[model samples]
Target: MNATLVAVVLSLFSAVAYAAAAVAQERLASRTSDSGVVRLLGSGAWWWSVTLNGSAALLHVAALKYGPLTLVQPLGALTLVAAVPLGARVAGRRVSAVEWRGTALTLAGLAALLVTASGPAPDDVLSVPEALAVAGITAAVIGALSRPGTRPGLRHATASGLASGVASALTQTVTVAATDRSGPLLSAQVIGVALLVAAFAAGGLLLAQTAYRGGLGAPLAVVTLANPVAAAIIGLALLGEGLRGGAAGLLLALAGATVAARGVVTLSRPVPEPAQLPTKEPEEHPIAAELSEEEHPVAAVLALNPQSASYEPVLIPRQPAPAHLTPL
Candidate 1:
């Protein structure tokens, strides 16, 4: 098969894996009250989710190896579209109609933005100073956004999604750098990039997992929108890429983004009372209650000894029985 075909296949598979992982992680978060990573790590389901995500990352790398960033990265957004139905089925929960509409809008907007964007350009190896600056700035932003006081809803999820997007962009950069270079594997530049990649990737995973603590729709939308956008920015700024249709393309991209954002906001709005399933009432068991009453010997004993004090057997004389025995 041609490289493009391979890349397309890998990207599709990667998106599926990512979607499954997202569902698994969301289910884990919803069920677990403990927010600590250590506790989460102990769960089998969490580990399974991690495995799925790791597989997705590997497949994504393979796709990038064979395809352009512009094509492969945007396709990753399909994870959000795929996750909604997968989560609803696996978790046995119904996604609200509003959420479905929002998801559709987000997906459509993301596709427009990616399609209008320019093709990938040749990128030079980033200097040590440039790498350090980017890493420091990104770390600072993520740290600030992840502070304890931040509420655990759209705000937290948006911050996490942005961080994840940055991490993804960095991963692509590092992958390119590693592939293009023909030096010793343990070189200083390569090592530094590897460390940066690890740090960013770890941070992204933590943030994404935290985002799942909130509902799936808004946070997923943010991540879906932000990831390719961040990558596109990196491609334009550092990699020297330009838009296809210039001004018109920019306008179209902006409009698409606005539509997507509106959709997300609509989805994140409070669900109507009618959408929520009512709490089931406990069933009455008249037969069981009657059977229980009949089976207990304590009640019969209490009835037979109403006059007996301290629940002890009384020693009554048998004078009439003795007279009957003398006649026999």
Candidate 2:
């Protein structure tokens, strides 16, 4: 079989594995409130998700070995394509039309972005200093985004993407070294880079899992888009892979990014009001419940009966002031 054909087959299966992993992560996230690493590691389901992710990563690496970057990278967008429907099925919900639209937009935009961004497979590896710089920068970015904030899931997804991208870059260095028999395997440099790669990869997985706590579609899309873009940025900066098609390519890339961003925004939008079930009425406060309608009609009305109203104020009987309580 042609290597390209093998790569195609591997990429497709890799996408499926990745999609399944996302679904598993999302389901676990929905069931658990805590996204703590310790809590996640303890769960059988979470570990299963991690297994699926590892399988996907292995398949992806195999696919790359068999094919070119341009072919393999675009195929990766299929993870989002697979994830939307897969996540909906797992959650026992129908895929909303809005989700479909968002998915389409995201895929189309990502395709454009990948087409322009991907060039020849980069052979260059990061120097020790460069690797350290990349690791430090990626860590800082992930830390900043993972902090408590609005759109926590999206923030975490972006962090996940950045971490994954850096890991990919670092992995390239280690893989290249391993492939070249001329160099001694297990050198200190290789060991150090490999460790960095492992750290970032683990961090990425944790962040991706946390991203799913908000819901599935938007966070997944964000991760999908951000990952390649981050890697491409590194490639352009360090590996001599320039954006294709010159100025036109740059314009197209920007447009694609905008469209993808719009799609993510669409996916993140709250469900239509009509589809949401009415929320339960708030429980009465204990003090409010203790007030009687007659004795404290106003308080009772305000707390227990929104429709009722009274102007009368409760009158306390005048009692002789205690010596200490008297006005100075």
Candidate 3:
């Protein structure tokens, strides 16, 4: 098959893996009172999530073989497209029209971006010092925010997402840089990139787990957005790929992306309302102290009170029973 066909097939598989992984995360989120992240990561769902994510990564590398890394990496963002609808379907959620609008905007932006990504390859290679600096900076940020004292899952997720993006950028750089060159990436650069990818991915997953504390939407959104932006930057800086039509196209794509991000922000925008336990205020008392007026008459009391709520009075009612058994 042609490379474009290959890329398309790979992207589809990537989407499927992401969709399944998201479903697993959502399941874990529903089961927990706090964020499902930590517990779910330790549960069966976590393993499922890992499996799906691994599939996406595998497909991603496969797609890279056919398309430019710049072309292929950005498409990884499609995982969200598959994930959102699948998430809602699996959760039995009916998203509001506004959420749909937001999703549409995001899709438009992504489409615009892919179309405008035409360009010749630029340089491939990061000096060891630069890679080290990036990795250190990203790692430090993740370590600081992920400390025990930080805010709950959403915040941790947001912080972790940024780190994950850096990891992806470093990883793709390594992947692309070593694609055709090098005797073996058992060399220092490959090893360094692998370490970088591991650190970021591990941290990101932990953060994503944290983010799901409330629901799956927010943290996942952060990761989705951050990963693409980071990859795009690396695609440009390290790979020499650029917007097809220069400044104007880049500007339009930027505008579209901004709109898309706004849509996601809107979709996952935190609601201010505190979650309320089922309110008991309006419900009738389970066992009312005072009987209703209808129960005032002896006859009514006897009739309305089901056997479940009746007391024997210790004075056997003057009623007859069948011969087989008698009340004690």
lDDT of 1: 0.68
Per-residue alpha-carbon lDDT of model 2 for 1-328, expressed as tens digits? 7665786789789889999998999889999888888898799999999899999988877765554454565566678778767866876778788978887886777778766755554456678888898889888888889886645678999999888777766776777666667889888778999999899989989899888989887788778767776776766687555668999998987888788777766765654534566799997565555656544323333233344664533333234558999898
Best candidate per lDDT, number? 2
TM-score, candidate number 2: 0.73
Model 2 lDDT, residue 285, Cα: 62
TM per candidate comes to 0.73, 0.73, 0.73
Candidate 3 Cα deviation (angstroms), residue 320 = 20
Show the colliding residue pairs in model 3: 35-213, 37-209, 122-240
C-alpha local distance difference test of each model: 0.68, 0.76, 0.66
Worst 10 residues of 2 by lDDT: 296-305
On a 0 to 100 scale, what is the lDDT of residue 32 in model 2?
A: 87
Q: Give one digit per residue, the lDDT tens place, for model 1 in 1-328.
A: 7665676688789989988987887888888756688998789988998899889988987776666565566677678767767866875668779768877886787667656653543345456676677778777877787888776655556566566555555666566667775656556776786688777766666677778788676676677666666666665676555666789988887887687667656655545545566799985344334444334223222224565544643222223335657665
User: Alpha carbon lDDT of residue 172, candidate 1?
Assistant: 62
